[model samples]
Target chain A: MLITNEVPDGAGHEDPGHPERPDRLIAVREGLEDLALGDELVTVGLRSATRLELLRVHQGAYLDELGAFCYEGGGDIDEDTYATYDSWPLAQLAAGAGLAVVDELARRGDGVGFVAVRPPGHHALPDRAMGFCLLNNVAVTAAALRSAGERVLVLDWDVHHGNGTQSIFWNDPDVLYVSCHQWPLFPGSGVPSEIGGLAALDRIVNLPLPAGATGDVVARAFEEVAGPVIDEFAPTWVLVSAGFDGHRDDPMADFALSSGDFAHLATWAAGLAPAPGRLAVFLEGGYDLAALRHSVRATLSAVLGDPSANEAPTNGGPGSDQIGRTLRERASTLTLVTAQRDAEEAS
Target chain B: MSIYPRTIAVGFDGSPDAVSACAWAMATGRRLEAHLVLVHARGLLDRFDRRDPRALFGDVVSELATRHAFNEARLSWHVADGDACSVLLRCAEAPVFADLVVVGSRGRDEHAGMLIGSTSLQLAERSAIPVVIVPSTTSEYHEP
Candidate 1:
């Protein structure tokens, strides 16, 4: 059972030339269309993210400012991020999509919850909007889960780091943030050195891969690095920041993953959940239309136990050396971090 | 005894407004003998010239450098892949920790009539340190 909310990918939140456009949503729908799930896919109308839910990961003032900005006929939030009059409402729906899916998944108790919402939220901060994100949707959901006493594990596989997610969950001991992203890319925060906040040491796992890394390298990073971290963390719920831009054809960042690779990732993520219905996936990045469709198709199908062989899994790529180096250096990094924390506390 | 603003960050986008901003920041840097960190946000989708922004700006930035002659060591360039506001804020906080941040009132994107660019305004509101927005009408600023 694949559970998700059906929200209109509104035109109210769009910039003409920006890659994070309305058509990206259409591409996702087309991907699902290709799947032909036929009654296996359950779609529900999205409820607007309540202020209480949003306040979990975002500040009250920033939300008010964003709402006011949208009401005033929003323009460019930054060079790459933009908002129009309908953006605030649409963003609310997007943020709410995850919460709705989580609840539906809980009630049904048997399906993977995948949300393909607009203005992807992993890049959004507590009080600031960055990287075309209006609100931290995944963070919001994680915080709610943590509040309900469930240990949450956020797996960010976007081509770019989910800097905002890391920052928000940095201090929480119950929530672990793991990211595998292309290094030297936008927002620039997913280095191994950024282990986690003092309280949550070793909780943040940063797998900064090279540009053309294949699924093989990523799998090793997971099996060797993230696997141990996830095992020790033993999270009750798993959330994925599922950005498909690592696809070879995506123009944004360079990663050689194909649709088949997405199938591998989704299958791996499903295994991380405590149970069958405990995993949820949210859209983060992926600009190329064709690539987005194929990747999404493969990911959802694989998660639903029907693997899409439309694209073949790739191997013999780069970044294996980097993973070995990370494994070697992790101990020293933790020792140094612990010493710094001690010195600060002693002072 | 604050002695604040010992370092300043300036946003550069190779636009005319950015040129004016550079001129103003350089002038202020001269008065205070402060470090000038020129920041350019290379968006992920940005295929904008990867070469030094100064190289892209050509004679205009060259002219600004010649006019506001300061120690070469005092000026550093940072081309980061991020949002303009986020990158500038990061420069002011860690690694750079600039005491002040400055940018043009508008960049290439803004409509000509707007009072201030969105990036400038957002930075001003969020930055812990002071921020300066150089107007397009600004000519080269000089201090006695």
Candidate 2:
């Protein structure tokens, strides 16, 4: 099943020469159209996320300031991020799209939910905007689910570290955060050594890959490393910080992945869900319009086990060594983390 | 037990207020006999572009050397690829482990009316260390 946004495109939020503009949503729609599901496709739109829902992930003071800033005519939040008169409302709508997908999937009890919304959210922190994200959409859904007592695994394969998502769930034992992105890149936080907080040691599995790393390396990291931790955690729900920027064609960061790689990744994520209805994907980033279109088609199609256009997963690239490196780091970090937890327990 | 500011993280982005902050940081670093870490966050746009992002760092250091006769050993600069606030915050962690953070009230591309830039506000709100938002008019405080 496919879930879409109720709000209009981010026209008011556009900045000339900016990469994260309004046309991204159009590309996503085109990918969906190519599927040709006809009656089989379930197109759903959700209401704007409530103030209470937003407050769960964002600071009240920040919400007030951001809303005021936008209404008063927004400008660049940083060197890259921008906002405008319609941004606050559009952000609320984008966040709501995720909640809407989760709500509908829970009600149906059987379909893989995908929400394609702009103002892509993984990079947004609880109190501030970073990268191009204004608010944490995936976090809002994950938080709401956590409140209802669900164990969540936030699978972020965005090519850039989802620093905001990782920061929000760092100390929470219930949410397992996994990220696979290019190392030494923007907002550089994810490293093999950043195991979760003291209370939630090993809760985070950070797999930082080198440039030109192929889809085969990514799959190995997921299935071999994150796979076991996920199984042990036994998450009741899975929320993907799905970004197509990793495709070789995108200019954002270096990771030589293809549409076929995304399909395989989606299939792996689909199997992690405790139930078919417990999985959902939220858009984050993808700069190249054509790559975004193809990657989206392959990913959404894979989730439903449907036939769609795809490319061969690339291989024989760098970063194969990263998997072993991650394991060694995890083993060493666990020693220190376990001690920290033990010391706290004693106190 | 906490020196609080034995090491100061100063943000510079080639803006007017950024210069003011750096001047203030130089004098402050000299007075307290502290180490000053000049941090510049290279955003995604900068990362994609091939231009050198740290050109301004040398100019500022030259100015400091002329005025304060600043000891180069007491200062260092870093260009981490990220947003302004995040790079400084990360520098405060393992290697640098800065005890204090500082930034200008506004940055290069901020609106003219904004009293404080997003970088300064975010640093003030998020930094684990104490933050000092140096205004553009921060008189180059020398040993007085």
Candidate 3:
């Protein structure tokens, strides 16, 4: 089930001509339409998150402040992020979509869920909104599961690093956060050296790619770097910060990934999950209309285990090889994880 | 003078439709000055399961109740260890009594009913108290 808020359909806005406009949802819907997914795709309207649920990820004061900000008719969180009259309630609905999807997946153990909500959440801090985001949806979901004594793996594939998510889970042992993002992008903080806090070195993983990195590198990063780490972690629940701005056509970033690459990445991640139903993807960022649309379709296909999903092969770039080497070197320090993976695979 | 029932009891299973029924019941309870009782059937699932069913579904129930809590009606919840329909019926016949018992036209099972779930169907048939089965198609009963 796709849990979504109708907010993207003109309920709110960032600016008049902003890239993260309401039409993005329409573009995504058009993409879903193009794929001819009848019963394969089911959609449920979002339930607004309760104040208590929001408190799971955000401080009480922050919630009160954001609520006041929105209720007072909207303002700017930063130069980039905006809030309107509809923004606060819509953000609540966006955060609620995460909870709904997790609830559905955990209970039914069936259909794959995608939360196509906005304002996009990966960049939002627990206290302040950033990069057109209000609340960190993926982070909120992870916190909910972790609080429930479930180990959660958050895989963020946005072009820009999921600094907000990483910050929230930086020292938490139960939640392992991994990101593959362009280094010199907005909210620039995902450096390779920033593994995590003192206790969480093995829990946080970042693959900071340079400009012009291809999907080939991303695929290799997951297979050689992210995959082995996930095997060792053995998380009970998997949450995806499914961002498509890495696509070559996106104006927001400079990565050369295609839609096939995004699908390929999702397939690999899905395989790493204990079960297909354990995986939930949340839309993060994808600015280019065609790129966002096709990438979303490809991701849905991959998550659904579609036999005919596209797999556009990479041309083999130096960008991927360098990242592979860096990760391989980092893997040496993660001896416990490496040994655990070996034992699990051998069994 | 409100024409609605004084005590409304709702059957909740965390399905979209069930959540919607809770919303509808709350609205009606507010109008009629009723006390709302939400009954969840844990006996429907396997008893051997390690986790507490209430703990697993507590967040959802809390969200549902909290949304309608500030209204005129008094909201309370109960976890029953029996079939949903049977438990709801028993609540209706209790001394405190439910004037109107509300339930979703369907439960969580996606394909169980053409329009109504077995619990709702049985409740509609056997319950002596007035029963209001909210259809999944009602736009007004969106999840709270």
Candidate 4:
């Protein structure tokens, strides 16, 4: 399932072009239209989350503040985050799209769902908006699942740590949050040691990479740390806070991931079968138009098990083998990650 | 091989964008018969030992230079301590003449604009010379 809302008419400004503009989604939609991927493509309408859903992970005061901030007529919320009048409603739509995707997948028995809404969510905290995010959509969804008595595994690969997602679930053992991001950038969190709360220690697995870390490093991190952890956790559902900022061409973060890497990661995630009806992805961030579009198609193709369906080759040749070597070195660290099932069984 | 003998300053931060920028710089320097300066800025090292930073920077410089076949004499590596954008600006202000300033763009988020990371933006906005914002996704070399 692909969920999206029509780009709000006349919502953008005259600022020097930023990556999180309407063009990003237009490029992605154009790419999908070009793919001719057949019946696999399912478009769904964007919806607004109810008040109860918003309260799932955010404080009431924060929501009230956000509403007030939007009502004041939109301005820079921070160095990176923007809040325009439409941002509030659009953010709700994005978060709601995330919840609806998860719910639909959960209700349909077994399938992969993708929410292609904008105003990417991973950077939003429980009470504040940062990094261009107004809502922690993935966290909200995870909170929803936890409330519904389901265990969730959140895999975030945005080139920057999903700090909000990590912080929201830090103390909750029911949610397993894994992030692969370039460290020492932006919000400047996600050190290897920021594991989680005492009870949920190790539930949050963070693989921080030096800048210039490439697709190979990402793949290895997944194969080694992320994949093994998810396998052990055996989640009732899998949620992906999919961010394309890691794309090699992306101007956002320094990690060197290719479209193929995104596809490979998606395929790897889809392999971990969630209980009966629970696997979904919510878009987070991706800036460059070509890279974002190609990466999104590749990710969806990977989830659907048909990468070749897209057909057009992305610019540039395959990446260096050094990326592969980096993955191997990083994956070796997983030897220390305790298996979740094994620990539970022993207990 | 002494054609123009220009100085090419390449910013290094151990990021893919930086590495690719360095690679592009080395190739450009070689093509232009210019000297290559691999400027590796020492970021906040409060948690890490100072010696570790020196060793790490030295290793990266040596490894990248040797792997790319740029002459040690033609390649000069310097490590400075400060904010990445500030350090880059300082380097640009130095007396050394540079034909081009090469840096990598981390891209833009809703928070940050089109120039991508702040460093790229700073260089683009403040550099005295032409700035090359190599996208992280770029696989091939771009001509100046």
Best prediction by lDDT: 1
Regions more than 4 Å wrong, model 1: A342-347, B1-9, B15-17, B28-37, B48-56, B66-76, B85-144
Q: Per-prediction DockQ, in order?
A: 0.33, 0.51, 0.01, 0.03
List, residue by residue over A1-347, the lDDT tens digit for candidate 2: 65444535667668888888889888888888888768656767656888899888888877887888899989877787888899999889888888888888888887887888879898888777778898899999999999999999999999999999988888899999999999888878899888898878889999989999899999998888898899899999999999999999998888999999999899889888897789998889999999998998999898887635569978888988889999999989899879877898999
Give the CAPRI class of candidate 2: medium
Clashing pairs in 1: none
Superior by lDDT: candidate 3 or candidate 4: 3
lDDT of 4 by residue, B27-131 (tens): 677767788877665432212223344455667667666766777779776555433554566565565466677887752221233222256765687777677
Best by TM-score: 2
Model 1 lDDT tens row, A244-332 = 99999998888999999989988898888999789999999999999999998899998888788578999999999999877767667
Q: lDDT by residue for model 3 over A1-347, one digit each (tens)?
A: 43333334544655676677787877777767767776666666668888888887777867777777677776544335568878888888888888887787777777677888877898776665666778898888889889899999999999888878988888788888999987655565676656666567678888877778887787777667667778888998888999888888887767888888887888887876787578888888888888888888888777777723344745464476567566765666566555666788799
lDDT of 4 by residue, A1-347 (tens): 44333333324421234446777777777666766756655555667887799887777877887777677766655335667777778778777877776766656665677777777788777766766678888887889989989888999988778888987898898999988787655556665566677567668887777777766666676677566667787888888889888776777666777788788788878877555446787778888788888888888777777764333322332333433444454444333334554577689
Chain B TM-score of every predicted model: 0.83, 0.85, 0.77, 0.73
- Residue A214's C-alpha lDDT in candidate 3? 82
What class would a CAPRI assessor give candidate 3's docking?
A: incorrect
Worst lDDT 10-window in candidate 2 chain A? A1-10
